[model samples]
Target: MKLWKSRSGVAAWLVASLVFVSACSGSGGGGKASGGAESPPASSAGSASQEKQSQEAAPADPLGKYDPPIEITTVRIVNDTYKYAEGDTIDNNVWTRSIQEKLGITVKNNWVVSGDAPGGQGEQKMNVSIASGDLPDFIPVNSRQLKQLVEADLLMDLTDVYEQYASPFTKEIMNQDGPNALASATFDGKLMAIPNTGSSMDGTFMIWVRSDWLQKLNLPEPKTMDDVFAISEAFTTRDPDGNGKPDTIGISLNKDLYGGYAGLEGFMNGFHAYPRQWIKDESGQLVFGSIQPEMKQALAKLQEMYKKGEIDREFGVKDQGKAAEFAAAGRVGMHFGQMWNPLWPLVDNKKNDGSAQWQSYPLVSVDDKTAQPRVNLAVGTYYAVLKKANNPEALLKIINLFVETGWGESTTPDNYAEHFTKDGVERHKYIPFQAWPARKNLDIHLHLLEAANTGDKSKLNPEEQDNERQISEYLSGKEGAELGWAYERVFGKDGSFKVVDKYVSDNLILPNEFYGAPTPTMVEKDATLQKMELEVFSKIIMGDPIDNFDKFVSDWKKLGGDAITAEVNEWHASK
Candidate 1:
């Protein structure tokens, strides 16, 4: 049995009934892959063009000659299901140790656990610290938890810290990524945390139809919602795979709600019935999107599909992974997901049978509507930092390190690269995944990593050589391989670059008005509202009477949904 503590200072032990916690855990330039078209014929080089490109300098060092070094102990929470390299430990890894060595920083772990839940000893340790009022210098918390901490005044205002010390590169990213992200982390006009950035890279999600199946059936790819229906009809009626058994389904829905909502409702958006997560109605009152009349129409269409045997009947229990399995097995005709879906899940499925030919299609609105598919801009899921032990500037220092190391630069200088090579540390080791240098200077590193992975530098352009250097350096060390492996996984030969390219070329990004963290009113009711949302959504999707939706909406309003909206709107108005 194991005991865990909650934030309120209660000691709870884990019994056989409890689950175990595990160790804590790029987008790019490229041409699009053809639909059902085998690999686009490779281009033949006329002659290898070798020109060393001019490189940019590192951002000016921000912490100019501070007297004595300050030590800060930051407590980090990593995902439980993280697959660590063979010898990797929570205390040491390529990512964390690089900061310690390069910047004279020391990050001490108070406790660590896996999953969003702070389970077992990790939760217990955090609770004990809170009860004792001995919290660490910095705790990078989740959005929901951040709301609680803001009410408690346990966080430091980062506005002044950011203004004084933030590197130009990071500042530029803030502007490029949009102010809504900052708005999410600010409270009372003071920035509370450094918001994480996701490439507002538009069009990451698309409709994936089985190209081989489409060819077998001689059906055209869907350009609109109606086309989607037609294809699904054919996929279900005529055995597209020519298999003897009639086991094919037109579409497989995960019923996961959030991920699919954007795609499913995207069709409704074409009809001007935009079923947004948060929307304002005719009376200018903020309302939830799930209960909207528009959602009913969307559900009705899905219900029709379900009745027609077009949608998978077992969607309720099928997770994203399982849905991918059905698609790979050729039992499902279409699925909606981000562009990276193929190499991530489908490409891997080729292990079972190499002929699983899947491709992406931009499902344009059927009504000739120009309303581009709206994708959400992510602010900060993985973006967090540890506070310095006694010195308040420690957090700022770490941010500065992330910026100066490669924030504005194309690649680290050759001298620094050499230094990294000699020390057995990667020049890009301290470079956080979201930094500007990593994002903008990608062409350089692309050439480099590709050369190393495929062992052919002649194929790389001058810019790609930079990426190759960092990739090679990263793979040389015992610790560096963790980061190296992650990079390769994202952009390698079988990486997500191809699908990501297509997505970026299409879609519209809706920059939501990022509100501050949850307020006191939400403390008592947020959980109830969340539960209500899932219950109502599940019931409606599972063929509950349409009238039940009205009842659900009424119940939701009564159960803190209205209050939460009022609080959110009040904050929104202030912003």
Candidate 2:
């Protein structure tokens, strides 16, 4: 066994275990085919018949079940929100049972850990597994872990397996965002891992405003940054809620300035400045975005807003949940967030005050130039196999066939309802590996819109049928409207994803220039640099000198930011 001095070192070792085992110990049980017991032939005719039966018994289909059971060992991250059917567990559910019965494979969890557990204990356990060289047949890991494993040469090359075993639908789903999605998992011209693809649009930001407040104040919908400023100022000072108190805030912000909700990243995008991202300059060299001239302008505006009491005075201490209280209580009128914002704190606002009506709009630009929502590539997780595993291709075939059988075009409504969506149980959670099409949600919305327009549900898929009914109930203002309300906000005629579709069509998204694994300097000094950035930016937002922005740029460059930049550019150039 290899000893590691640190958790990252252990993680790197664990990642490379499969390769190490394959190189040292040779291939193992994963590749062998199990055969039935043969009987001695009594005559020539019997021998010929037995030979024909043997040929027929061989597993020929890509998704064909193993004649004898095959067991794969791994660990599981049990999501806190996952719901199970009565008497079902992580090891025994419709998903797991189906895999056993249909695929002739059993998944044995070496251990199970809570996804929401504190201190990242699950990841720490994984590191221990690596240091001991006691790795399972296969596992899913993040980009950083995957990178370490690749560097250590402890993973299998999955290029041929994927090409040979992946179903056509799976291939289409993985490639929807183009080569970058797959390129993230590719190292040195070899596909090192199977990328878990998610919708890039899910990360795109938008400006969500309370429509009822807009109507109360008689303000036109925000179409420009100036309009947004005017609305925020009016909401703050004019008592749009009619409580006759100066207790309202213009826009809600959180302690973490960059995230999916209550973040300033979207707000900065309005000014054509992307903070905490890597962007390309006019000369085509990648640079850190936080120190750009555009960022200084944005910081100045935020500082002005802070001094005018338009932003939360205690925002530096408030996290997303804490700052969300203002929105939930209807004390705030506008915030910059993502598509799902309406389903969350805004939903709480509606419940608290039925009069609160929120709507999503495309981000407004500061000038004539359109504001493009900054989106990083959504390839976060990867599935890699140990080289010693007999059938590394089995993972590919399993995911491909599982998706097709359970949720693809070939899926039947009856089977889907019975095995997958029953009683709100997330049956998909039981599958050891999970992947989704990049356009799954957007496609659902398009279908929902079509169904709404035509007033017909005959052509809708099973999931869409359920959504259509929920949206109809909400629009009709029936009992149990809250459930429908959330669905409508996400999938109805004026759903938040409508803007996502428009952005996709117009190509208005600014993807991060750097999506490769973390650079050496980044892995070493990124945390410190990030902390400094947040502190300086927070102080500036809370009334520090605007010139402090320049000082921050200087400090950031001196404190490892320059090294990180060089490393990122080097990676970019090599790619």
Candidate 3:
């Protein structure tokens, strides 16, 4: 097979990155950093190197260290999963120290906030900071917040600095997914923020199934919507778990119906419904997906499934984490999720039950029409330099180093262990200024697939090489080898990436039509409408009349959705 070229990202659709910069101008004086934020430098052993950097003049050396060094304060949204080495903190990790040693940059966090999810403490604290008009030198914000910052004129336009300071390899990584990522960061022809480009085309949802259970139940693999529904029924009622009890669940789903895991996007796609997307109608007008007739039909099928005891009655209260527990316990036989999900709840289930064997399949169509899963791989996090920061180019330099260490010619295996990660610890995320090559993971999958076929893995990068080793051990069936099967499921011949290949090769991707900033009407009303839609959908799925969908459609239009559609189309026209 020819190699695939693309990247993927974490649960971008699931993670809410809510930010809003107020009209208040940046105080210019930095905010009070938690823990006084004093120490962010290379170890004293590098003092001579620091002195050497201090003696040199600033140059456009893509990886050049600053003369005399420079300090840039920023805030961070620390994830729950972040674990540091001893004597290290979020602002003083391997990444921070590497920046000090290699770039002569001292990066400190103005304040550390907990959790990166939307409406989490990090989002709330950032909102308060925005309201207080205290921002760090270079701050990361989401698309929603970037739009407001652009309107407030509180951010530096990075067009010139990016063009001048970015290395050729860095530029290649930034635009790896073509111009869409950069275009998303651009406003009024100026690049206001450096987009942390992510995977979109490679990020579509697929149906993950308990393949062993299918074999146990004497069932065929799924090819159409009928087969999917049939499998759900058999898994739910046929004691697929062999417990002689009707306890196995048909499908696993989270309360938030659209995410990388346990979401209904793949299920919705079965009926030609693309929720949370903007698609051009036959009339050539951009239309919202949630309110379409297609969505209602899909919802009706889900409602029917819920009524048939295939779905959990109280799913509205369960988040993805909680929903993952059911799958981990081996009660769930199928799900709709992104490609990375096998490494998560599915792996847990496999580890829990050695007999468990889950696999991903392309989302199938309900009729003669092909299924097209909606995907939004747009850049979510953007690093914007403060309008009054001392060094805007520092952001570019840091990103350059970040990219170089991970993907550029300067990269070595040591770079991955030293600055990017350490023994699976994702220290690369702790860096204040960071961006990823958009197609890195997809490239890994392709490389591994080719290596698996040819048995020649010399050209594989560090990450791909590690995955190859894990897959080898798993296939060897060594002690505790099954744990590595998650990697196998993602990169092996039968892995989820193979399903991704099929979906892309067969041209079944339904890319989001709208990727611009939230239109004015959407800014004001989108959240409320989304809330209403979810509540209505949950109600209908849990025994409420299906006609409620009709009411929801009417109310959505009346409550600013029509206006938002108009604004969206206007932006589309401008594009």
Candidate 4:
């Protein structure tokens, strides 16, 4: 099923963003408080220490200071699997509830609409507000739409608010939680939005192959890019499934709609040229990946595969879901995904006998040349906010509570997970840590495993709280195998923990630290230009002639690609 469609219908999409600052000057600081003024109530604690903390920390106020209940008006943006329920207005979602009960803020839904609805009412509502000169106190917008919002000047400046209102905890999160978390949110040295900060963990075009198929085919697991071709060829031609039909495909990938890492073109990562990643060359000049000479070779290989009937013929039009469906039903031999791919449409199918039976593997070294793999990692979706939010420092305050509650050095996993589970609003949809930021640390997993197995989660130090909670939940039979793996690593004294521990100990987790910021070029350019890029890239991967790929490069440059490059570099220089 399609989770959430992109929102659309800005009456004048370009104009809104083009003249945003000029348009939204006086739109802020308006309206009388709606709904009865009432502070969020105290929460239920499943344990004593948690109850003590709740009692001592002031009920339902994570922002540190409990202000008189202020009704915060906000526009809701529905994401995948996160939607508006019937008779369940936006004011009653897990996010709003967390804001009220934890921060003493009352949330009011000023506008509500669905992405799946026709005419893009949800997206249009925000556009209409901008056009009509009525901006809500807060709007949770994705990065894609954030550019438009920035251009339209519909959002609060957040510069003064961030500096003055942000708590030390929130500041630390933006500054210390790896690199680029806040950088992505900041534009021209101003805090535009509170970007989400977890997608950074994702990298590489992870390919999920059938482990059982490998064993059945009597073939060794693939270790290099050449092996990918061999394995795919075997699956397609050698009857790896034993069903005797040549129905199996070597690989299934979607070109259109998906974009970036998981898209069909992402397979090009094995060829060492990430199709969507705009990287600096040896001379520090910005360049598009698809136009690189390396890409020609990659496309040539893909074309050869397509001609061999090893690839799915329907690739050109297939979307992520459709391509993934083929793999899930055992019709495709291999599929590319992020590390968490199996947890989604594929894993969801495990209930059905026809569910995609798959296994995860790291990116194979292709060409026997480049050892480094190229993967795109996104930073944050949209920072959520409560409406009529009086606590400008609310984000910081909640981060503080979560940080302290996570691994404040003396906390234990069992205690933290039990409390977090009891207080958990939205369950992590994919990874165990998706719901909250603090749950991402691997160390926290170690502590939680200790707590869960010993029945004393509180024994874990605060420093290990997040990972510990994850482990505790998993060991306690929570959803997600990754969590279970963490638990086993800790309690079973498994080698995985030792390996991860060493990585952490030596600080071996080296992620790209790009200086990211939205540029006026992006705002100035027409959306069609980028849309064209996605379309052409998709076509090239779906068996479009290798020469057509050359045309795409020229077209991209002519269509604002060069301008965007200059703009990005200019922004980088200014920073």
Q: Return the top candidate by TM-score.
A: 2
| Candidate 1: segments with Cα more than 4 A from true spot | 1-60, 63-67, 80-88, 93-97, 117-132, 200-204, 260-276, 282-285, 371-377, 380-390, 403-507, 519-523, 530-542
* lDDT of the candidates, in the order given: 0.51, 0.72, 0.74, 0.50
- Tell me the TM-score of each prediction against the true structure: 0.70, 0.87, 0.85, 0.68
Q: Which pairs in model 2 have colliding backbones?
A: 14-130, 16-154, 19-154, 30-390, 31-390
Q: Is candidate 2 or candidate 3 better by TM-score?
A: 2
Error of 4 at 177 (Å): 5.6
For every candidate in turn, the CA RMSD to the true structure comes to 13.5, 9.8, 8.9, 11.2
lDDT: which is higher, 2 or 3?
A: 3
How high a TM-score does candidate 2 get? Answer: 0.87
lDDT of 4 by residue, 443-495 (tens): 34454455656878555453244444554575576655553332333323342
Off by over 4 Å in 2: 1-61, 116-119
How do the residues 1-575 of candidate 2 rate in per-residue lDDT, one tens digit apiece?
A: 00111111222233222111111100011212112222211111212232233335432244556556677777776655567778989889887787677667788888888752322766677767766867776777777778877787677777766665566667776787667888999888878889877667766889988899899889999999999999889988999999889999888888878765688888899999998889999999999889999998998888888888999999988777777789988899999987666656677787888778888899998999999998788776788876655456457656865556544655667766666556655456577775566665676678778776887777676667777777788789896577577667766678887988999999898889899988899888989998999999999988889899898899999989999999999999888
